[model samples]
Target: MIDPVIERPRLTRYARGGGCACKIPPGELEQLVAQVSNRVGPAVDPVAPLLVGLDGGGDDAAVVELDEQRALVTTADFFSPVVDDPYDWGRIAAANALSDVYAMGGRPLTAVNLLGWPRESLPMELAAEVLAGGASVAHSAGCHVAGGHSVDDAEPKYGMSVVGLVDPHRMLRADAAKPGLPLTLTKPLGIGVLNTMHKATGVVFAEAVDTMATLNRDASAAAVATGVRAATDVTGFGLLGHLHKLARASEVTAVIDRSAVPFLDDARAAAEDGHVSGGSRRNLEWVTPHVDFGGTGELDRLLLADAQTSGGLLVVGELPGYPIIGETTGFSGHSIIIR
Candidate 1:
């Protein structure tokens, strides 16, 4: 009654760094980019202007004006498996990559697969399953997964490079958050901890899986419908990490209500049990100097900095169902203030 294939080594074991947490530390990445971000390059007549450049802080994707009315939003995201199920991992990665486009108020147009695999170790059948899962999610978004590239590697990896279209005037920019705007996070935190625990214990968490795989389409639509101009999806950078970048870029201070923030079931308990990831710890350290954690404790801090994969949009204005976690204020030494 047991399938020998399922008895093979768990997928998580092959990964060196799982999910978006695999990204380079935010501090180091900024330092490296600061050195070359201003380099001059050969130029020609431009079809469109760069609306959201990397130098502007933490935009979800790059946008270029395609015409007087529409702009192209482009972003790519991929990582090793965060969960053991190949199909589920594929779905999560696809949703994660698509979030960047949605975060910019764009409708996904097309995506091409990006994969890394150890052909000798993993069967082609399993790879097909992963591709099928990704295709399913992309199809649900009404986006085409036309083609892709693959390479042989030690660890198996998957994701997509997505392109979408947005209105030039209505696109959300990370730098657009103003001093008086309220911050509303559309998803719960602690996904990193939950994932780490799952990786270590092999316990399946249906809720976290469902959360990561769910697209931010509805939330993005809500933000655009409400006329919001500033938004960014919480991904590799935890809430605190991304919020710090947004606040600093906008030259404002973010005041977060410690108790108002939401968390996935047992996320705090997992953190309390020491299930935090190295990436989450790095996020905490990177944000420590900028946050005033009035009465919040270490557990809360870790949860706030928990690295997320396919997280939700942290929009500048309040929406119907999302919780208002914070508000923005004029320049302060601290980028974030927890009360």
Candidate 2:
């Protein structure tokens, strides 16, 4: 438990960008990847065939076929603080990192911490709290927190590198979406705007924090059990951005029912009050060309594209307890249509 006597430092202040919002913009990242892929050329019959890597719209993790029944999934993710509380920030970051494995319909086996801290500015005790938080969550997920690496840096950062296992035949892919399938979202939107508001005003939004910290384990299990093949977590890119990626990769167009989409209670209020993050705005701008926002206001559009941290899985098929936000259709010149 955090001590009541000692005043906690605002960790977000140390970060130039919070959470996954710190990620390189998707548009720019694609260009860099294209150039690198061109030079690397194609692998010619490797020992273990690569099931998924930096291809097919950049799936959640790199999955390599281990055998007929199993494949190995590996992914690494880290980001600066998103909340003022170090422990909560740690939990949120861990969940976000583990989410990559879950998004690909895999179960986490183990994780190693990746930490960057400024020794001169913050006490080592605070870092311990963060690590403790991560360990606690990983334990709950039944994943081992074996060990990790740390570095001294100007700004503090924390996350993990995770390894998981999945059945090669049952694994999910972003490019597996087919026309006529419903889109199911496991969590609500507006986390980015709420987080932006929290950073600016220091008002705690417990719901948003909980949302980010919540694991996608159950959702992933449901998708795989239901035989849903296409899925991706709603993170840095936001819903519209990720949907566009899935649609483009699957050679289909996603039609989102703006009204059916869910959002946190205060998400709209925060956006209306101009509490949106630059990353969210940038996400909107990046996917604007491919998105047909019919009769949707700018504010609604911004909310839809709000950059998320450890958001939720956007599955390509319906789930019993989740909301069906939209459906996929044959390619119609546009990657996403919001009505």
Give the top-scoring candidate (TM-score). 2
As for candidate 1, its clashing pairs are none
Q: Please write out the lDDT profile of model 2 over residues 1-339, one tens digit for every residue.
A: 123345677888888889988899999999999989988887787889899988865899999999999999999999999998989998999999999999999999999999999999988998998999898888899999999999999999999999999999999899999999999999999999999998887888999999999999999999999999999999999998889898999999999999999999999999999998888889999999999999999999999999999999999999999999999999999999998
The model with the greatest lDDT is 2
Candidates in order have lDDT scores of 0.90, 0.93
Which ranges of candidate 1 are over 4 A from the true structure?
A: 1-8, 38-44
> Model 1 scores what on Cα lDDT?
0.90
lDDT string for model 1 (1-339, tens) is 123466845778788789988889999988777767667652377667888777665478988888889999999998999988889999999999999999999999999999999899888887888899999999999999999999999998999999999998998888888998889999899889999998888877899999999999999999999999888999787999999988888888999998899899989888888989999999999999999999898888989999999999999998999999989999788999999
